[model samples]
Target: MHFHNNGNLFPLYLDIRYSFNAQSLVPFFAGAGGIMLDFSELDDTRIFINPSAGIRYVAANRTAMTFSTGLMVITGGPNARKSFINFKLGMELKRKSL
Candidate 1:
């Protein structure tokens, strides 16, 4: 899944993620980002035009985890780029939802 200042980039996402088939599984990682091609309004569900990136992991039918990293260019707020890098680790039974 992807989102930007305009709205959700992709409503649904699916991928052939890789994983380690073991008692303690290894997850698959994925990431994506790009610059805005046009301008738009901002709201509660909108993110301003800025450099953005995100990472996600999925364990073989067991667990799924996701995290986002990015920089926000605020208007006269702070002449700084809001950056973040996070991670998520969780367990899944029948299906993954983390």
Candidate 2:
């Protein structure tokens, strides 16, 4: 994850995820803005609260793909009021191995 300010000072955040099996996954979320969480395999719920961009790569069963997402927070600055939400999705291959 990465964030940039008015002076182009980019602060980065990182998170590591590990899968134990097909039904169990654990993630250690971390960031530069003092954000952290330990997510378990309970209904596949993950949360992030930061103003930055991040990329996640998942590889399994000899296949790999990437997922990306971004976060933003709008503060009442002297310039204007900005509030928006964005989502992205990408697929590498779609087939059945039989």
Candidate 3:
């Protein structure tokens, strides 16, 4: 889950993910959805949906490198409904499975 804002708009989202079993370069898929709101008024809210795909590489110390890309669809807002492509890169710590 994540929240982002740039003074004018606020975006809140949650991602459902699944990782594939692999020795290295694990691939995953996610479906995400949430709301985007104009900061000035509560009435200006848009529902957003996203489906994403990514790959992950785990390091020796449990740190993982991740790269992902997706498309986001925003509906029902004051502005015209729109869609955009998005990309992200980040690192995460993974817990060992019991």
Candidate 4:
């Protein structure tokens, strides 16, 4: 967390991955994809790669949760050479079965 609020960046990603034992209670995943970085400041606009690995869990109700940790190598744009080690948590709501 930073005290400065001037830095605003939005990294839009597909969050795609290959899952192992997809139907199991605990599934492992790993993949990397191109990401688009959106920043108001000047400089480069190039696709960045964030390789990640994590586990996902699905409940009986079809709701799911995820935990991930990865190094996001974002070296473009202002304050150039930008990279971060991040931990992420995500959720997927239950949807109607097809």
CA deviation > 4 Å runs, candidate 3 = 1-7, 94-98
TM per prediction: 0.29, 0.28, 0.78, 0.68
Q: Quickly count the clashes in candidate 4.
A: 0
Number of the top-ranking candidate, with lDDT as the measure: 3
Clashing pairs in 3: none
Ten-residue region with minimum lDDT total, candidate 2: 36-45
Q: lDDT order of candidates, best first?
A: 3, 4, 1, 2
Model 3 steric clash total: 0
The digit string of per-residue lDDT tens for model 4 on 1-98 reads 12123554555556677777866456565555464444554344445667777888886577888898888676555446567788889898977889
The local distance difference test score of model 2 is 0.36
For 1-98, candidate 2 gives per-residue lDDT tens digits of 22323212222335444333342222222222332122222222223334334343445544445444545433322224344465545444546869
Q: Which has the higher TM-score value, candidate number 3 or candidate number 4?
A: 3
Model 4 misplaced regions, further than 4 Å: 1-7, 10-12, 35-46
Ranked by TM-score, top first: 3, 4, 1, 2
By TM-score, the better pick of 1 and 2 is 1
lDDT of 3 by residue, 1-98 (tens): 22433336677878798998866789999889988777677666778999999998887678889899999887875667788899989898878899
